[model samples]
Target chain A: MKKYKILANEIIEFIIEKNLKRGYKLPKVNEFQQTFGYGKSTVLQALTLLDQQGIIYKVQGSGVFVRRNPGDLKEYVALTENLGFYSNNQNVKTRVLKLEELRLPPKWAVEKGLPASPCYSVKRIRIKEDGPFVIEHSYYSQQSVPYLSREIVEGSIFSYIRQALGKDIRFSEKYMHVVKLTDEQAEFLQLEENDPALEIKEVFSLSDGQIFDVSRLVYNYKNSKFFSQSSDEILS
Target chain B: MKKYKILANEIIEFIIEKNLKRGYKLPKVNEFQQTFGYGKSTVLQALTLLDQQGIIYKVQGSGVFVRRNPGDLKEYVALTENLGFYSNNQNVKTRVLKLEELRLPPKWAVEKGLPASPCYSVKRIRIKEDGPFVIEHSYYSQQSVPYLSREIVEGSIFSYIRQALGKDIRFSEKYMHVVKLTDEQAEFLQLEENDPALEIKEVFSLSDGQIFDVSRLVYNYKNSKFFSQSSDEILS
Candidate 1:
């Protein structure tokens, strides 16, 4: 292996092992060269190589720091167990568009195990600072678990269900499809009607296999990205 | 749980255990009723629920069939071990955009453990039957493994390496982000400039810890959806 390549690998291994988040400044060039006993050009080349990978950045006046874009598109694995829209990597905000009591259950309410009975229907728009990102239509079994207000809908529903309602988010089956946006959905997202969007539907069950909730999320194709990584899984 | 829900759960368990693929038709209504000894309403209600979840479909004047849509957008787990653009769910076509020799390796080539020298660079555009979808740029160490043709590139590179060249895929790491499309990328995809695009970067290593390959893929937002499900994991 080339000397500089070996040096680059060492630096990369260091960054990963350190578990450094973004904005972490690395040691100076001389410091790196002295510690690794590598020539100046070799160390410099290693740094340049890492920069090209978008792993770190070199400021004109300041030292090199880990590269972390504030507005970079993050993704959701869309796991049914993760029954909320929250990202510590970025600011996630939810707006309750419509909240009402459904006297007559929606025609397909039983899809998520909710019977033909009254339920709480909640509509929300999720934003991540850039703009409206996803519109969500969620249904909760009112008879089984009731007394949720609009305020609770604004925050993380998963946390609320677990911490407040004492419900367990066991697992879910999810289906994903791409479709043209409807007029109402487009208006909520301020996009052209019939524009492409990605839809994900999930039916979640509690520990005892009782229906907990059912939701369909429509993501604006313009700025949304979904990501997932696992040893045995497929992307999307 | 309601009687129909119990029926639905039993049907779901059967699907998973049977390992039914897309387009695998289920039993007829009378068949289901006789097999489970359930009433007509109970069986019909369970079918209705599965239809809502996009699992099955009814053919008028005929029996029900398993659901499969050709244009359904699919996602990747973005694992480096995935190593190719092939998907078992659909017919994926690859068109080589550019293939060249890197006289001077890209600065980040070594970051993926490639030596600081010449390498084979590949660019490809992947399309499903619906439309053009993802653009990929990949690099491999020329000396470590040589002799790749356009035909091999069109198909699965991982398959060729493992079956033809006798190499083992050890593991891979991936990074994902969402960003505005570059003018050139948008033009290639026939999309609007600055449209949202999902980018995934992967670095792979062989079983011997040698650098296998590094690639970056960009996907058009219009007809793309990613999905991942497992027993133990949550949404990111």
Candidate 2:
């Protein structure tokens, strides 16, 4: 993880450890700089990223404060396209359900421009906030990362790809659909078969246009909504 | 509606009328200019908007083509934040459910920074492809729009406000949530009570920050998903 990310996590822990409530003021940059021993720029960057994630809101001229309703549906989805496979998907536990190396690509992978031959698959059931949250099936290009381990999958794969393999993710494209859960998925999620679910297919690529992974993610839909923006929003 | 929007709608109708399939190349720019009496710039802008809306896609070498499934889940949620009050909420028919002026405001209005003076309410049921698609309830600022009729609500109130009242819609703020249906909403949508649904609360403000409208929108959740972009996507 990046230094800023580590600091961000520490700040989150601090807030939780202190039981910070809405409108509770967080320490200013100088104070954070002294406390965390991070540079001024690192503290500022961490604060900005935290604000963007809706963890704390900056009230300009006044100070930064803990945002009310961190779990509010609206705040949760503010930049929804980037949800899942990130810090927000944090949980107490993750169970590895399947791992395999395959030569035949699924139809969706072929459609997403994944080349055939030499692919690794990873399936995971993530428990978020102590509840069944997401079931993900992901296929990776073996040529890119080349190796995987249960230990690495237990942590952030993106971090290992960046730190170990020295790869940087450029961007991701995703398509979402409302679907009925299959019997197996229902059992995993502890929901009834055919219950409504949100399905997302995402293609992650490196900055060099190397397709790294294609994933199918299914989220428990009853408590979730997505947030996204249009490029044409007029600024006032 | 703008001329580009009208032209875009005409193109949509053309595709549906002819049952254009995926990879079906649309007419070139000159052809659209000749057929629709549009200028080069107008044709280009309209095509760009259509492409952005996912009604059509541009191929680098071949030409512009009607996307395989313009009715796909992704397309429906493109630019979804400004739905109901705009032309993109296209359909076969719309049924006016209720319209009235009220002196008192809902608690949410004061919460949204709306004035407490008189306001008008409009309820509508929109049908797309011969099915109930959207139910919207809007509260208008009496000072901004003092007069409205069933006829105007039957069409786009934004049009009436723009063409008739000469008011321009600058931008809007929307909050989305997955909510269950109330009895009245269930009856209006003809769905079972407590069924999962997507709900949105929107505040439409003028460029000068005067809020002209507030809306609560509900969508039948069985087949719908939202599509949006993140402003921070690191373009490679």
lDDT of 1 by residue, A1-236 (tens): 57987897788668777777555888999999888899999999888756543456666677887653323423543232254447432477888989887766466555544533577788999887778888999887775557678889888777788889887665555566556678999998888786767677766655544455778888887667554322311111
TM-score of chain B of 2: 0.64
Give the winner by lDDT: 2
lDDT of 2 by residue, A19-53 (tens): 78655888989999999999999998888767545
- Candidates in order, interface RMSD in Å: 10.8, 6.2
After superposition, candidate 2 runs with Cα above 4 Å error? A1-75, A78-85, A88-92, A105-117, A209-211, A231-236, B1-75, B79-89, B105-108, B111-117, B179-184, B222-225, B231-236
DockQ of each: 0.10, 0.17
Best by TM-score: 2
lDDT of each: 0.66, 0.67
